[model samples]
Target: MTTKLPTLPSLQIPFNQPFATGKEFDYIRQAISNGHLSGNGAFTKKCQAWLEAEIGCHKALITHSCTAALEMAALLADIQPGDEIIMPSYTFVSTANAFVLRGGIPVFVDIRPDTFNLDESQIEAAITPKTKAIVPVHYAGVGCEMERIMEIAENYNLFVIEDAAQGVMSTYNSRPLGSIGHLGAVSFHETKNVISGEGGALLINQPDLMERAEIIWEKGTNRSQFFRGQIDKYTWVDVGSSYLPSEINAAFLWAQLEAAETITRKRLALWKQYHQGLIELEKQGKIRCPIIPQHCHHNAHMYYIILPDLESRTTLIKKLKTNNINSVFHYVPLHSSPAGQKYGRVSGNLTVTDDLSSRLLRLPMYPSLMSEQIELIMNTISQFLSSQ
Candidate 1:
């Protein structure tokens, strides 16, 4: 007699589902009717103005992606070859790749185990004469200790370029995450809270950089000034690239931006459900939940948990796969990657980054993620941990 093997469940929950606000299609139609589908059109200007007002930044320029914004920041910062930029290792490749493209060296630091942000305490020790800037990544939409980070930058005469890719609606001490730094980059990737399929913005807090930033966003030309009647014609004034997103993307993003608060609330509610449901597992020492400090007003960009070890995380992922629930692990610490070895150097031991990268797992999170889905995910995780 042959015993039948258990069949895997059909995929029921995906890792993320891009949300659509009601006005997106309407805005796109309007943009098309206006006959300007190129970058820096009416919709793009509206999006830029909205971001500047919302974030209270000196200026905001829409970019093709968060990577483009970071690259623009690198150019605006005037990073030179051999110049060092301090940042945590437990961040996306774009965080390092931007500066690396400018021939700047990335000095990696360890992260805080609680917040998974750059450890503010370790920044000073990494500074040297060649240090040009400090890029603090706000992991999981939780703000970094910007107050301390900014203070350090001031004393060292270093620029603060905030990698606020995951922190669109997040805040630190009531100040917007991207608005505090000299330059901040926000993402509108499909997975982000306010998405336009693939878009980003550069929040320029320093008034001095505003004009140059616009030039850089327009591919090294002073066309923005020319359009504003500040110049008769535009010409390449400095090094830059085609960082701007087209009007279609801007129109879609405008819809999301208009309903930002509602989307954030829905995501937060789902995050809370996951948090409350898994509290017992956290209490039982089976897993660890995300920690948001009192000062941070997070945007609920993601909800993640820390398993006991890599083996445990792997097992849980397998279990979730069998149950048709999609969960995922985050970045491989940039400091440990091949490019990092060639373009960057670790200033201190990335103990927390190394450990967390192996143990952490992100659950499905998006504005469209239903409460029932979250409950199912939590229940599946609880069962897996209980069996372990």
Candidate 2:
């Protein structure tokens, strides 16, 4: 009798996986067949309408990327040199970079360990006369303390720009995440639940800001009105950049948006599976998992686990690689990063951020992550820890 070998599992599991429903092909076909490849085309309008209707945002302008959308927000806020914008340090660099580009000072704040979001309690102490805005990033698709943050903003007479990059369709107390702030930015990068290669949207919540927001998005030109026939000819009106995404990208995103509910449902199911499957290990002190706050209805954008320490985390990652499971980690605190050191000013010691970065690991998550695969992943992690 010949001895049998165990089946090989793929070593590298991608951190984020996008799902393409059937509607993507249909929209791509329609977009190509229609021959309008410019920005602000029919599909763009459709996408805008769908988002406006679904997200409850006053208006949603598709942009080239989340970074662009953030830039637009800073511009709309009239962020001048030395204007301080407060945000948590544990976030994508773009959260601070946007404000930095507009000559705004970024005040890096520490995050609450449990939620991995800006510590609302720590915010009031950081405000000074130069503080112009408060950027509350919705980390890992989890909601921040929006109501509390807003109250502080109102009291301090500050602008609130929500970085909803990972929180699309995720809500807080039945209200959408982006709409709660004056302006918000969302991402549709390939790593997101819905993708259009590289794309984003700027959410305009204040009706008064709509006209200016549109202008800034069109590179400070009145091109949007020109396309809408409200103006005979578009001209350079203000300072801006090419923030609009192409029609093809909009069309591709439209496909995903059309099937948004379905995609969300599938991903949520997988998220729960991982949560339940890994509960035992977490309870046994092997690792820790995410905990959704009371008000948040998260989109399951990522599923991360915190190991005992850096050495154990490294050991587990290596074991997973040996098993061909491509798990990963992300975002060292920006305040400590080289670029952040040059521009933004750090506030306090980032103890929580430093601790979390060393222990956290993002597991493979996608709409197609089947139940059996989740079991395999959980078992492999468990086996690796037990072996130690």
Candidate 3:
């Protein structure tokens, strides 16, 4: 008898779901018909105002991408050649890339095993005479130890740049992630909770820094004032780049912001479901779910499972693929990556990062993911673990 194996299922579960189209089109069209399709138009202003009011940001500048927003942060902070920035190794390449682009040394530090964020305890030890800023990335939408990090930054007179790209609406001690530092950056890439296709925002927390923030957002020009009629004409005041995103993208994001509470409730429910459902597997020493701290509320951005080792994690991913599930690993420690080697310094061992990256696998988690899909994914994992 000939037996046939089933084909691997297309992730039908994409890494992210872009915005809902109908409302988005209406909003975008409203911006266009209102006679402005350029940057900082009506839609852009609405988005910015909402972010400032709701997200606890003093002001927000919608940009082309989070990467651009981060780069602007580096520039505004005056990150110069030979300056060092402290950040966790278990982060998106952009976190380090932004600083490095401004000729800043990326001082890599290990992450907490549980939170997968920068180990605040290790940050002070990594600081040097030239250390300029400390960038704390709130990994997986869980807030980092901001209090301790801020204390350290204050003591050393180092600037704090919160990479709150995933921490939108997620808070630390009741204060929003982006609003906690001197400056912060948020992402609206298709992969993030919010959507503008390819967009982001820079959040200025320091009241004194808002003017410079706006100037840099307008490509180092005083155009923001000109647009406000505060000036008759605008010209380059200092070095800057084109960071503002078009009104269309900002309109799309406005829809998401309006539905933020709804979307967050659903995602948080799904996150709890995953936790409760996977707890059995965790107890069996098969997988580990996220460790949510008492003081924090997470945004359900990423749901990861840490297998016992590299081999088990790889095997699980392969098994999930065969069963029509798409699971992926993240961030091989940057220090070991080719680019990290070229520009950064790895002070101590990244044993935790090395271990976790190999062992961690992110599952299908989104508002659209069905209950049936969840059960099927878990059943497949159970079957695979039983076999092992």
Top model number, lDDT:
1
- Give the whole-model CA lDDT for all candidates, comma-separated: 0.91, 0.86, 0.86
347-381: candidate 2 lDDT, tens digit per residue: 76678888998899989887766688788888999
Could you give candidate 1's per-residue lDDT for residues 91-201 as a string of tens digits?
999999999998999999999999999999999999999999999999999999999999999998999999999998889999988999999999999889999999999
Clashes of each: 0, 5, 0
Q: For residue 357, what is the lDDT in candidate 2? A: 82
Task: Please provide, for model 3 over 143-247, each residue's C-alpha lDDT reduced to its tens digit, 9 standing for 90 to 100.
Answer: 999999999999999999999999877988888889898999999887787778899999999888899989988889999899789999999898888888888
Query: Mind sharing the TM-score for model 2?
Result: 0.95
TM accuracy, model 1: 0.97
CA deviation > 4 Å runs, candidate 1:
1-10
Which ranges of candidate 3 are over 4 A from the true structure? 1-9, 19-21
- Lowest-scoring 10 consecutive residues by lDDT in candidate 1? 1-10
**Candidate 2 — worst ten consecutive residues by lDDT sum?**
1-10
